[model samples]
Target: MTESPVLMSVDDRGIATATLNRPALGNAYNGEMLDALIEGIPRLAADPAIRGLVIRGAGKHFQAGADIHWLSAAAAAPPEQAFASSLQTTRAMQLLNEFPKPSFAVIHGACFGGGTGIACCVDVALATTQASFGITEVRVGVAPTPISTHMVHAMGLRHARRYAITGERFGPEEAMRIGLVHEVHAPEAVEARLEEIVAAMLLSSPAAIAVTKTSLLESNGLALSAHQVTQLTNESWMVRAGKEGKEGLAAFREKRKPAWA
Candidate 1:
């Protein structure tokens, strides 16, 4: 049997860690990875023992985003299959965003495309000084449909619109300036800061924290009902399976500008 594509472990303190294990591919996400994340996050969230969650990559890069090879193949897949893949990723992000406990992303190296989406969904996103980020879907002639909501939530609509359109990479300082990251630290300091934040979270009442999160989302007009989230995720998948998405994936693989450009 193939080894699992994602890994989850929890400490005695109810601190859960979710690692993206596809290091060889710079942690690029595929269908299997998405399914794993979608399934794992809720399980962790529902666990009374899990007080906090931390998301990270297995290797140097945080996440390079969607697997281009998978995306290329997905472009030619049946519409249903292709759309299902997109929905899986969208669902994973939603799960993290709506998780009751405090969620954090410990980012280093490249955090691009869907990676940015994941980081955006977390309540606290801390990046090493060397970390870089971008919403690069437009470069390949596709849209960041699924991640757009989280991106706007993290960086505001104005910044999201500019960066999503430009697909330009930015460093940790820029990310903080643009409101994408909560803090920037040395690589060695990431774990320390994460611990500090997690400790702070633990001091608050768990139930109260969850309720506060709900109130905050509602205040920001981001509290999506279950049905609304499902519907929006489905729409994201539809776009990813369409002509523009196919062309975008093809363009990236071919190392050429998309025809739409």
Candidate 2:
């Protein structure tokens, strides 16, 4: 039997962990993974026994972004399916960004595209010193619209504009400097640090934490509306099915510069 794309568990202490499980693909997301997150986050959120959530990726890399082959296939899919694909991506990010409980991301290895988006949405992001970060959707000619809002919220507009457009890879320190991550530690110490943080989170009032988080996002206009998500999803799917998206994916697979480059 095939293993699930996402593995989720809650410990006796009521701390939940969601692991992106496609190690063979560097945890690059596909529809199954996105749907798992779309379904799982809310279930966990509604559980009174669950105090907080932690996001992580299994194996050598955290998440390398969407699987390119999947992107190519989605681009060729029927319009409704393609549109829904983009919607899944957009909705998953929005759910995490607005999750009711305190949430944390423990990042290591490669973190790109949607991975960076996950980092952006979490209340706390802890990365290993050796982790690499990038908002690289543009490299494949697909707009990073799904992640754009969170990127701007996590890092400032100036920083998000540069990285999302350029698709440059930066190290953990640079990630911290840009406000994408809260702390960077040696790989061996990162898990320890996360345990410390989660313990601290558990000590706080869960209801108060939820209230404060909601207020902060609403006051700053970080709360996303359904129409906004639809607009983003439309832009994302339109580009994936366009000429530039086709050429870009081809160039990447062929290991060559795109025509525009």
Candidate 3:
């Protein structure tokens, strides 16, 4: 069998760890990884024995968001396929956002684009002091449509608009200040802090926690209509297939400033 793009394990204590496994590319999200997350998150949500979840990344980075190569391929796909491809990251974020159990994330290094969405979706987002974050789609002339709602939810519309439009990368301190991350730790203290959170959560009433999460999400979360989904999908594809999008991708691949700049 082929190696899975995302790796998952359930510990003896019923804590499930879903790891973004493509370290060689900064744990970038590609089609396979998105599929893995879309399939894995809901499956984990449905498992009765699972207590909680910890989303993390392998190697140096947590996630650099959508793979640039995947973005290029998606840009070239048929309109129908491109729309579906654009929505996969959104779906995966939704699944984890509405997960019935407690969700946590351990972020380090680059948490860019869709990666920031994953952090926003979790109940508790922790990052090392050295971690960096950005919405960043504008840098490639692509809209941050899929991650927009979550970004707003995490950081508020004002900050979201500022970062989303500027494509500026900020440090973990800014991430925490903007409420995208709950805690920041020194590199060596991250694991201990994670365990502390996990243990505290394990002591809570699991049923009560589930109900609370469901209630909160239903009351104050992103609820998109069919038309809205289509609009966002179209927005993503439009930028990905547009002249600027092509120029941006080519510039990224060539390691140069885009033509517009």
Please tell me which predicted candidate would have the highest TM-score against the true structure. 2
Model 2 agreement with the true structure over 1-261: per-residue lDDT tens digits = 989999999899999999999999999999999999999999998999999999999999999999999899999888899999999999999999999999999999999999999999999999998899999988889999999999999999999999999999999999999999999999999999999999888889999999999999999899999899999999999999999999999898899999989
What TM-score do all the candidates reach, one by one?
0.94, 0.98, 0.96
Selected candidate, larger TM-score, 1 vs 2: 2
Would you list the rank order by lDDT, best first?
2, 3, 1
lDDT of 2 at 142: 91
Minimum summed lDDT over a 10-residue window in model 1 is located at 232-241
Model 1 Cα lDDT, one tens digit per residue, 30-107: 989998988888888788888998989988899998899887776677867777777777788888888989999999
lDDT score at residue 98, model 1, on the 0-100 scale: 87
Name the candidate that leads on lDDT.
2
> Candidate 3 residues 69-158, lDDT tens each?
999998888888888898887677777878989999999999999899899889999999989998888898889888788788889999
Compared with the true structure, all predictions reach lDDT values of 0.86, 0.95, 0.89
Off by over 4 Å in 1: 226-231
Q: Which stretches of candidate 2 lie over 4 Å from their true place?
A: none
Give lDDT for model 1.
Answer: 0.86
* Winner of 1 and 3 under TM-score: 3
lDDT of 2 at 207: 97
Residue 147 lDDT in candidate 1: 84
